[model samples]
Target: MKNILLGVMLLLAMASFAQPDTAKWVRAFPVTDYMVDISDSIRLVQVELPEGTSFKEKQLGLLKGIYRDAQQDTGTIGYGRCHLIKGHYYYFTINHKQSGRKPKAEDLLYTMMDSKPVYNGAITKLASHFIGLQEVGGSALYDRYQVFLAWTKTDENNVIDSIVSDINYTGSYFLQSDAAMNQQIKSGRFAGKGVLDVMMATGKDEVFKFLEYMAIKPNLYAGHEWKVAEIFATWLVSGAPAVIKE
Candidate 1:
């Protein structure tokens, strides 16, 4: 009887050691029908700021989420798919009359007002929010007219919650890592050597504290619409400000 008891105790101890570290696969998406393990293809861990968290804790949390994808990036040179900051987006659209023919470089006017310096220092304003640029249309001889520009706003100080949403992106994780990596590689050298892509290949998805994914909202003519997309004035960058050239 004593020997039986000892065997049962040993089994219990081993089982306890093998238990999962978490109860849920992740918090972004929860399983209702069945339980999910951490090894599942779609796993997310959502962390809520406790009610009593201090200001320092909040700052630390921001820093952690910003650098979550850079675990392997040793250099102080910070870079990532989303180098967020505190700022607000100031929306604008520069509409020029393009009769029928494709516009020349100068045809891309920045303002409609002549009474005052409507577009004074507009290039600097545009550059402030510029994240990157891409040629989206097909053919150099034909439909290639407009370029897409992305940037974060730098006018107001705001947090992540005010910026991103699930409508944009969920910080692709779980089993979607393969698809994400494939898309990155397809972008050629631009993303072939991206820091986020490498992290995805190794199954390292970061917990998005507030925002996820970003894209430029272009007009039908592939130009900036009358509205401007807003972002905060302050942001976190892995490196220097990025410039998107035409």
Candidate 2:
């Protein structure tokens, strides 16, 4: 009897969460014909919530799930995130779910691009987080963050040069295992490497090019590792903490 009651309660909770108020109000990411042309590589279906509503993580249960399903029905998406634009909170999903045919961006919506993405105050916030992490004194984390922190001191010109150098360089950092990587770090194997090496270890060049793509032409990096690179960029620019998933 107790188990039955518990299961009933869980179902009720899930049902409520599955249709939260956020889902009541939503639309597409202001799609335009010009946007569709530039959006060829953009895999996510960008949806905007009603104006004047702030995005609360707890309130996104249904909203997230709704988009997750939408993504499945759309072939362009690979992942997702909630961001703000034009005084409204917008959620973008990399739409991977689809039937036999992929939808064109022009068919997704009919609107014009109104605003652009800005780095905003994220750079300063990112710096503060790195400082806090370094003071905590975890050797591996410190090594990882140090590269980003060094980025704080340089100009865009130097940073872009380094990114290009990594892209042009031929050496790839491949490791046999996590243990081997830790051993490499201990031995200073990647000492002269650039900022991206912290997250990707040996995939620095790839990460650099991806991030550069995101910075210079975000829509061009629709799928294929864009979200992970976005997460790392958010960490470096917005001070989001690192989450390593093995």
Candidate 3:
């Protein structure tokens, strides 16, 4: 009996070590269902604000949703953010040292305003809710122009509840690791080796032109729609303040 128990403990220890580290995987992607509400037709427009102005200060009308993405290189630096309010898309960027000086709120620049959407449908704003759930998985719903995510291993057998549960599982994990993602922006192994081909093919190139401008390889994983979902989840959390571009 003693020998058998010791063997069992050894096996359990080995199994624990064999388990893949899913934390990074979970952070790198989203776990949710993205469905566009067709009746929700809102024209999104890009807007510019003077230096250091708080977007929340502007009565942008109920603050529908928001998204933030940013990165930097040696010479040029960029921070981009998007706000959806009352069906209007107000997007802007903060370029560090674009004029070869210190960054100030007044130094922000607004890029070209395209009618293109930062996302295809209404965004679900879930903040720090799903950061602890394990056994997560994700996929793209290109037909809906969105990504789908759910638990890979769960006892909940009901298909409906399983679907509903994902509502709160947006890409909060991604934002939680903003520092790591930004570091990857500069020195990721997959840096700029054509990881953005699918993204570029989807008419979303302008959304990430900062990567091109800085000559850094886009560090996002393809098909998972991590970028889109990160922006999607930012809507409700009201998101982080613009950081100085590295």
Candidate 4:
């Protein structure tokens, strides 16, 4: 009986959360066609959301201050904060914005505060949650890429660079593994080519090129280069793209 009662209570809680027309704020922007052309390469998606969403002003102010300091200290893109409030749901998007291209790690950080599992789940979910809260509508391009960018003093090892190197190394290993299996099969030492080899050969170049583009043509702010880079990098590395299952 106790278990049954708890189950009923849980169902009620879920039902309440599912109620509609409860969102209060939303913001939307359009994604350019050029961005769409590279969407697959970078693993990004275009989306729409509402405008005038409620955001935590105080936090945003503090983040802006931090970004100013970061710019002065590193000359790289820093971070900014945006908030969303809907019924009882609240979150933030520490992102970068650009006029012509996608942002980079040097520009933005799409983080969610006041939510469980910080840095949890897909980047799209964070965007979607913000949109849902605003209850407004707009669209923009989103790269579904996942790459890290670390910021450290000049003398310290760059954390972001280290992470990027690690990813590339892992990718290279997979490529080599595929090559080995192929050679063995051609020599009649194995049954046939393995799936791992095929996958490595297929999307590897596209992924590498996409990362390079991000590093070079990263989206930028009107006058704040570092701010743009930080936001863009955060979005790119936050794991927004759907994982391809082997």
Which residue pairs show collisions in model 2?
43-76, 71-97, 72-97, 72-98, 73-97, 77-94, 77-95, 78-94, 79-94
lDDT for position 209 in model 1: 14
Name the lDDT of candidate 3. Answer: 0.24
Best by TM-score: 2
Per-residue CA lDDT of model 1 for 1-246, tens digit only, reads 355335334432322221122221100100112212223222112222122211121111100111123332211111011112223211111111221121121111111111211221222122212222221121121111111121122211121221222112322342265454322322322334433333223211211210111222111112222111112101111221232335
lDDT of each structure? 0.20, 0.29, 0.24, 0.27
* lDDT at 228, model 2: 39
Q: Which parts of model 4 are misplaced by more than 4 Å?
A: 1-54, 57-157, 180-212, 215-246
- Across 1-246, the per-residue lDDT of candidate 2 in tens digits comes to 355335334432432221122212111223222222125433434444344323443122111121222544322222223333444434333232332233333223211112212221222122111111111112222221233223333443444344333322322222223324222222233343332444444244444443433333222222112223324433343332222224
Per-candidate TM-score against the hidden true structure: 0.20, 0.22, 0.18, 0.20
Clashes of each: 28, 9, 8, 44
Off by over 4 Å in 3: 1-76, 80-88, 96-218, 222-246
**Winner on TM-score (3 vs 4):** 4
Least accurate 10 contiguous residues by lDDT in model 3:
122-131
Candidate 4 has its poorest 10 consecutive residues by lDDT at 130-139
Q: After superposing candidate 2, which stretches have Cα over 4 Å from the reference?
A: 1-48, 52-111, 116-177, 181-210, 215-246
